[model samples]
Every structure is written in structure tokens, then in C-alpha cells.
Target: MQALAGFLWWAAVFLSPVVREATLGNLDPVAVAVFDIPLFVVASAVAAFGVKAAALVSAGWTGAVAVALAIYATVTTEAGWGVLGMGAATAGSLIALCLVLLGRVPTAWIIRGPFAFRPAIPRPTAASHVASTFGQIVLFWGFFLAAIPFAVAFLEGRWAVVLLFPSFAAPVGVAVLILASALGISAAVAMSTLGNGTPLPSAMPNHLVIAGPYRWIRNPMAAAGILQGAAVGVILQSWLVVAYAVVGSLVWNYVVRPLEEADLEERFGEEFRQYRDAVRCWVPRGSKTLRSQKP
Candidate 1:
């Protein structure tokens, strides 16, 4: 909800003609389009700080820029293509850039040690670490460096039709990609939910998540990641997404999980071991299960 509101509000600012006429000055549509790309990128990047405020602020700002570009394209003569193209570029870059910054920002800036300003509760466990981590890494790289390819593909109408199919055959290839990406994202989210935000350092106080999706899957975040990946694949219609989903899932299962277990074992010792036995690792062993049993 906050995200939606922020997006709409900022979007208005971006689309305002006050910016366009003042800058472009009756230039050809193509020239204006070319010019606006850099402007949007710079504007969005600069306005993007607020890691402690709320996740939506970043998203809202980016969305607004995209909306602005779209609105500009529609309003201007012979600039429809340019408008949408720039809008897409703006949206992709902003999201990617903001996320990368958020992921890297020191915990101190966002939280005054305890009082979580943005996502509120400092570093409270997100519902899904698998999903969260994977999503974060992807956004960090995908949005930052790889945005150009994505923009080109999207503008070409490569994966858009997946949004409306069976009505099919228009571009079935893209649809498959979207589905695969969604699955991967869902899986990652589900897996992360297993431990609710990676059991942060004891020195850093935060909420201990034990309910909602956390209760069921032990790692709903990971599951969500699988879903996210599949969704992206479908949305992008890219084989590379599928490969990523598969490889990433495997790495999480074989590598990341084991390492995490080792750390937990050392930290919580027998208590964590007991929890591990009862709580079926990746998938839920069912309800009425205990967090720690004597064995």
C-alpha cells in the first residue's frame, strides 16, 4: 500500500511538463527521448536515499520516474516510442540501483541500534531469507549492470505477452521463461522462511519472527524465491533465467544451507541441532511441531 501510494505520487512529479518543456525546448522527439534517458537516470539515482524510511520509498521514486516517462510519451507528438523506451530504462535502472545501495548500506544508518525507522523494526527477520537474499543479489546485479539488455528485450515486446496468454502462440517462448523465473523466486523465498532472517548477531536486537509464513515452511522465503525466479523467466522469456533458477537452487540446497547449518550448530549448539532434527530442513515436517525437543 505504501509502495503504491509513493509510486503514484512521485510518478506525477516525473511526468510534469514543467520538466519537459523547460529542458527539451521543442527538440525532435528522438532527440528529446535520447536526452530524457540520462536525466531520469540521474534524477532517480540522486533522490534515492532513505533505507531507514521504508522499502517503498525507493520503489515509489523509481515507479514515479517510469510513469513520468510514459506520460510524457503519450502527450508528446511523435515521441511515443521514445517516451516508453526511456520510461522502461528509468524504471529498470532506478530499481536496480536503489536495491544495490540498500543491500550494501550499513545497518547502523537504517537503525539507531534498535529503533528501526524504515522497515520499522531495525533488522527484523524478513519472512523469507532464501527469497530475500536471492532477490537482493539479483536486483543488485540485474538492476545495476544488466539493465540495458533487459530494457531492450522488454521494449521489443519479448515477454510482455506472457501476461496474457492462451491467446497463445504469440510468443510462447517468453511465457515459459516467466513461469520458470517465478518458480525459482518462490523456492528461494520459501527456503529463507525456514529461519526468519538468518538469526542475526545476538548483539543486534530485533524482532524474532515465529509466525505467519515462518511457521509453516521453515523457509517460505526460499520457496518465494523459486517463484520469483520462475516469474522473471516467464516475464523475460529468457533461457538464461531458467539456468539461473536451476543452478541457484542447487547451490542453495547443497552449499548455502549446509554452511548456514554449520553456523547455527556452532551458535545454538544442541538446541539448534534439536530444532534441525524436528524441523525438516527445507520443507515443513508439518504442524504441532516443536522448536526444540530434548531428544
Candidate 2:
């Protein structure tokens, strides 16, 4: 996958000049050949050969160059398609970089090494759990959903890349927001009361929680959060914010989920394994299946 991503990154960068010329009525093929081609070739080669350190450096360099090009195009070019193309290239480069990083490091270390969950001593009281959950909701809702979308809008405005949502999307956005919020609240309540812990990994629950939303889905909180993020993007009418939400979900799924599940497997063993096998991660199972499964 790393090799494939590197090759794709190279191909995208290699073709970018033609894309730019076709979209913006400008030609600068030499600039791409001189600046981008060689670096990406090296990145691809290193990744293909499994040279971990070299792959990391080269992929990071490729991503940096892509980001610079994207910013330059956004700021200087009048062509929206050109800017969007650059953004896609930038995203590809960053994904390739992430692949390199993930390939080089142990997956378990990502969630367990530096950011390992520390179970509360003497157990937290119900009031403590409530306070913690409230704080988390405020932080996630305020910073991630509200502040970040506004910030992206501000940047888009400054860069003249503003894209607005249709008027008809407002009701759909509101409905999704309400449903996702309800799911998140229910999941949090289940974790606090049944599992005897808060949602924060630093203060994770003591018992396996397979009640409420968890009886049907393995990660109701994560599902709810991702959906809520996308809903906010719809409400704010920002494609960039929606992309941000998608990127967050990918990070959580690939990077965080493994560590979390690893910890669970280590602690709960057969119980967690059984629950995991029975429930889908993001999708809720049917009521018929829920009836058959033991929580």
C-alpha cells in the first residue's frame, strides 16, 4: 500500500502541470519537471524498497512541496479548478506521507506508548464522570464543530475559495445534527453509568460497555462524532469542513482504533472479542441480531 500510494503521488505530481495548463490556460511543465519530479521519484523509490528512514524523509518532503504548491495556487490563481486540483495533489502527498509513517512505526505505539490510557484510581464518582463528559462535549463541539468550521470559512474567504451550500440542505443538516447528537449523548451516558468511566481515553471505562448504542455498534461515539462533524459542515456549507471531518474519521479508524481495541483485548480478553465479533464498528446491527447477541 505504501508503494502504491508513493507511485500514485508521483503520478499525480507528474501530471499536475498538464492539469494546471488545461484548467488555468497556463503552461509551466518545466517547473514541475525541475522541482517535483525528481523528489517524488526518490520518494517512490525509497518507499518501494522499504527504506523506512529515507522513505519518511522523502515522503515528508513531497508532502511539504505539495502543500506549498497548493497554498500558492490558492492565493495566486483565479482558476477554481486549478486550486482544487492542487488541493487533491496535496491530499495525496499527505496520505502517502502518512502511509510511510504508519509503515515505519508499530501500530500499538501510536495509542499506547505516549498517550496510554491511565485508569482512574479509586474510581471516579458519578459527578466526576458527568463533569468530565460535559467538559469533553464542550471542547469537542466548541472547538471541532464550531470554531474549526468558522476558521476554515475565514481562510476560504481570504483565499477567495468560498463555496456555499444550497438553501435546501439546511433542514437535512439540522436533522442529521439532532440525530447524531442524540446518539453521542446516549453512548456517553452508557459509558459513564454502565462501564464506570468517561469517554476520554485518559479516564476510560472500567468494564466493557455493550449496552445502549454499544449493543448494536462497537463505536457509537466515534460514529456519532464523525456524523456530527459532517452535519456541521453541511450547516456551515463548507466542503473543506466536510473534508476535515472525513480526514478525522480516517485518523481515528486507522490510528486510534487499533490502540483502543488492543487495550481492550489486553484487559477484557474474551469478552471484548465476543462483543467485537458481534457488533459492527460504525454501522448499527439490526434489532434481530441485537436480540440474539449477549452483552
Taking the tens digit of each residue's C-alpha lDDT, what string does model 2 give over 27-67?
35456556545566555566556556656665566567556
**Steric clashes per prediction:** 69, 0
Instruction: List TM-score per model, in order.
Output: 0.35, 0.76
Model 2 ranges off by over 4 Å? 1-18, 21-29, 41-47, 50-57, 77-105, 112-114, 157-164, 287-295
Give the alpha carbon lDDT tens digit for every residue of 1-295 in model 1.
2233334433443586643343232544356335333344334444454443333444454466456554544354323343443445545555445565565423243234543322222334554444445656577447622474365444434212123334343356456445545544544444345334432222211223334444555445555555455445445654445445666677667655665456556656786665566666556757556642110
Residue 129 lDDT in model 2?
A: 79
Q: For residue 215, what is the lDDT in candidate 2? A: 84
Show the colliding residue pairs in model 2. none
Minimum summed lDDT over a 10-residue window in model 2 is located at 286-295
